[model samples]
Target chain A: METVLRDAAAASRGAPLRALTVRVGPLSGVVVDSLRFAFESLAPGGPAEGARLVVEETKPAFRCPDCGTLYETPVGDYHCPACDSVRGELVAGNEMELLSIEV
Target chain B: MCESCGCGETNPHLHEHGHGHDHAHGHDHGHDHGHGHVIPVRSSALALNQRLADQNRGWFRAKGWTVYNLLSSPGSGKTALLERTLAAVPGSAALVGDLQTERDADRLRASGAPAVQITTGETCHLDAHMVAHALDKLPADGIRRLFIENVGNLVCPASFDLGEKVRVVLLSVTEGEDKPLKYPVIFREADLVLVTKTDLAAAVGFDRDAALANIRQVAPRAAILDVSAKTGAGLDAWYRWIEAPAS
Candidate 1:
């Protein structure tokens, strides 16, 4: 978030940040509530003061190596639902990115 | 707070293309206000940590050291297992992590292995930077086996990769048999699962079969080993497993 804010400040010639959008995935293992709390507590004193943080969580997704089927699971289970195989490779849900910033 | 470039300012100015933003991409220019534009900034939070971890992995490979990350909940006998392993295996070194103690490292050193304590202060887990810094304080040369005892916590330690050759997660019999099911994320990432404190399995009424079944469901790819560090039970097999060349 700080990185995004700095970039936004530079791009907009030091304009106050309005809002920041971030993406959090299930496999990232970061608590979204804690992230929002930390942002709220720390953003009050910086260039991001009074800025709103919008968190968008991405669901865990997996792909079957043998059958080529993409699917989503409840965080921990990696089994392929179509083939009943336990060898589904994770293809998504590990991302933690600052998507965009409004300044 | 950028560590890569020592800019005196707290906010490091990023390069125009640092985040790989492509202006050619589709943009909704409905708003005429130029003061606040939604800049597409796609940047990973863990990019720096992952890069450092890759560097640590390269360093370990160049040094010919087999590094194992040992993780488990508190009171899972991780230190005791390390003590037994160091006593049995020669040319072993350890980097122990804890919130506020040198006690585990002190005990491991007494077991005849050079050990260093990484006091994390209030950090819940050990990152790649901490392990890299601790490597400098210890006699890491010619060490065949490097054991990093992570801070005893199942949830946080599973997120940070310390660039270990293998991750070994421990589950004591004294804990519930459904530990693997309850903490599936850590088990899913474990290369090997050690069922420790086997001597007290019967006394504590620990369901061995149920525990193994749970582990199999969560971590089908992980090799499971049952060992008791107190009585030296199954230590030989564990030692051989560690010494065997990675497949």
Candidate 2:
């Protein structure tokens, strides 16, 4: 979470850290509540203290390499419905990122 | 102070933006100075770590070393596979990650490879920073291949990139065939899925076809190989894959 603080400060040109917007994907292995808890606990008396945090959750997006069909990976079914191509690239989601900071 | 929300006197921003109704014409300075605007970053939370990982990748590539990041659950036979690979290949080095034990590192060393143990303590995954620090501890200069045995985990480690040329996820036959289905994120990004401990498949009633189908579904692009450290089954093919320039 300090990474968010430090990066927000950097992005804001050394301005006092302010509210942050983060994107946490479902498959990012991060729990939003846990991240919020961490921020609340770790931000006191720091640059990000009292900073408003907005988390944007994203769904996983997969693109089939064979036919370029893009779809969400359905539960237990990974093969592309159109081409039967199992070689689908995960193009989105799986993201834990800092989207913006209000400084 | 030509005008614009008394901020024109102190705020450098408003002076440059006199484009009418820009909160102009002398207003109160009682409001928060740093309010109103949001800057978009749109960067990975691991951006710094990623930059470091990229450096490690380029460094390893420049040194002509093909690095592999090994991921799996605990008891997935990662150390066992590496022990065999290092013993057979001769010029391989390893960086082992565990919560606390140096046992994996010691075992690899005994197998005639320079190995460094990174005890991550509480960290579930090994990061590029740790890998960079461990690189100095091992004599990997002349080694052709470097294996990073990631801390035995299926989920957390998947998000951290270790700057490896190939990512190999091991699934021991003893570990249920539904592992890939259960942990699709890790398997989805794997380059090679080594189905280990094949010698015990029959005894364990491991469903080979189901496992293969699941692996293909999750990691169709990954080269799948069956290997057993105890019985040396399919090891020759494993070694060839490692040695193959096409990999």
Candidate 3:
């Protein structure tokens, strides 16, 4: 979030930011609430102060290495639902991205 | 002054804003501000941490040091296990992290192993930069194994990669059998899971089978070991596992 804010501030030539959008995936291990709380606590009185934080969550998905099946269910268990193979690896939903910023 | 935002004010007034909405794509703004522009930025928040972690990994590899990251919740006996390991293993060093105090590092150093302490202040986890800084305080040569005892946090520590060769997550029997299920991300990323405090398993009514089942379900790839750091039970196997060459 800081990185995006800095980039936004740089692009806008130090203009006060209005809003920032971020994408948080399930496998990112970051709580949305905690991110919001940090932003609220830190963003005040800065270029990002009064800037709204928009969070978009992405659900985790796993792909079976053997059957090459992509499925999203029973997030804790990465086994493929079709073939029941335990060789499934995470293919998506590990992202923590700063998608955009409005300044 | 805020370096990133440059608010210029030392004590900037905080604003109480409403919870923002979740949008799949670009926001549809009904009110058009003449100066408002949407700038796209796709970047990971952990990018800086990861870059430092890669540097740490390269440095460790060049020095031929076998580094292990020990992570667990508070009171999982990480310090005790590290003490025993340092005492038993020759040419081993450690870097212990904590929110405050040098107690763990002091105890580990008492075992005759060169240990450094990293006080994270208010941070819940140790990043690669912190480890890199800690490495500067210790003699890097002649150390066969370097163990990093992370801050006693199961959640935040799981996300920060310290560039260790192996990540060992500890779960004491008293912490309950459902710990793996509750904190599955940590278990899934663990290279090895040590079920510690086995000496009090029966006394604490710990369900060994249930705990094993839960761990297997959540961390199918992680090598699980049951050990009692106090009684010296299973420490030999743990040592052997650590000493084994990376495959």
Candidate 4:
């Protein structure tokens, strides 16, 4: 993570880099709150440190077999709202994407 | 760490296979190993893929192409359906995903439909990132319909979103009608359901009503179509529904 930040800084050619925002999907296996905490802890006193960190938590998508409603599933618990099934389709959730590093 | 079992900590085998005790015949351990170190992987490996999927979704929307993801079990006629569809609708492109063979792409290409094969290296499902890579490699230029035929696995593919507008889960009539109820998640997530191999319906004793009921039970709002790629029976309805403006 630190190495990627340094590369981003170098690529910017010393221009001030702003917040590093990322999208964390539930199925992506990455915890959003924890990642944000780690970022704040790791980004201090570094070349790309001190910049604001933003982590966007993406809800895991679920589709109810009974209703076919495509909606987000809650973390840790795999339950379908429309059908009340413990199991359903996890359409999208697992994702940790570096959207962009704004300079 | 035990070379035979990969048990770094407790010897679970010792309790079962210890000494003269018939149940413990094979058990032998030198010391009481401590608990295994649990590493919390707080990072999502799919983040990069999801971002690319979002970008792909945006690209598809911008280009006004209706992206359809076709998923089914192997030999369920997903490629054959696409091949038939290409014959019906000219100028449509497809990105086919498979574990090994490029035979599907070759068949589609023979039908005058430009198709690309994405062979996943032992991966069960095709993720959004893979789809993005395949799209770049395939070059969907001047294409109206974009079909992403996912790897032939009903289980894993239901978990990943490949930035498609519609998820079409096909079930061949030859396959049991109870499949939808058994694999409810895939059926539930599908926006449309295509019941293939209708020509063999009677020969295989495939109950059409029971299958439709099972589908409705799993996905109440999904549009169900029974199509025979062999006879082209009900193919026009399938085509019109897919090409319809409302969809």
Tens-digit lDDT track of model 4 for A1-103: 5433543444344545565556666455444676767777777765447666666777768777767777775544455666667446666665565544554
- Please give the distance, in angstroms, between residue B14's alpha carbon in candidate 2 and its true position after superposition: 35
Candidate 2 accuracy as lDDT: 0.81
Residues A1-103, candidate 2, lDDT per residue (tens digit)? 7666666666755655558899988778788999999999987876677778899988777899889999886434567878988777778778888887776
Q: lDDT by residue for model 2 over B24-131, one digit each (tens)?
A: 224334327646566677767776556667878988988889899999999989999999999899679999999998999999999988999999888899987678
**TM-score of predicted model 2?**
0.83
Give the runs in model 3 whose Cα sits over 4 Å from its true position: A1-4, B1-36, B245-247
Pairs in clash, predicted candidate 1:
none
* lDDT for predicted candidate 3 compared with the true structure: 0.81
Q: Regarding TM-score, does 2 or 4 come out ahead?
A: 2
Top-down TM-score ranking: 1, 3, 2, 4
- Candidate 1 lDDT at B176 equals 85
Q: What clash count does candidate 1 reach?
A: 0
Tens digit per residue, CA lDDT, model 1, B54-128: 878988999988999999999999999999998889889999999998999999999988999999888889988
The superposed Cα distance between candidate 1 and the true structure at residue B214, in angstroms, equals: 1.9
lDDT of 3 at A5: 59
Q: Rate the local accuracy (lDDT) of all candidates.
A: 0.81, 0.81, 0.81, 0.70
Error of 3 at A89 (Å): 3.1
**Ten residues in a row with the worst lDDT in model 3 chain B?**
B10-19
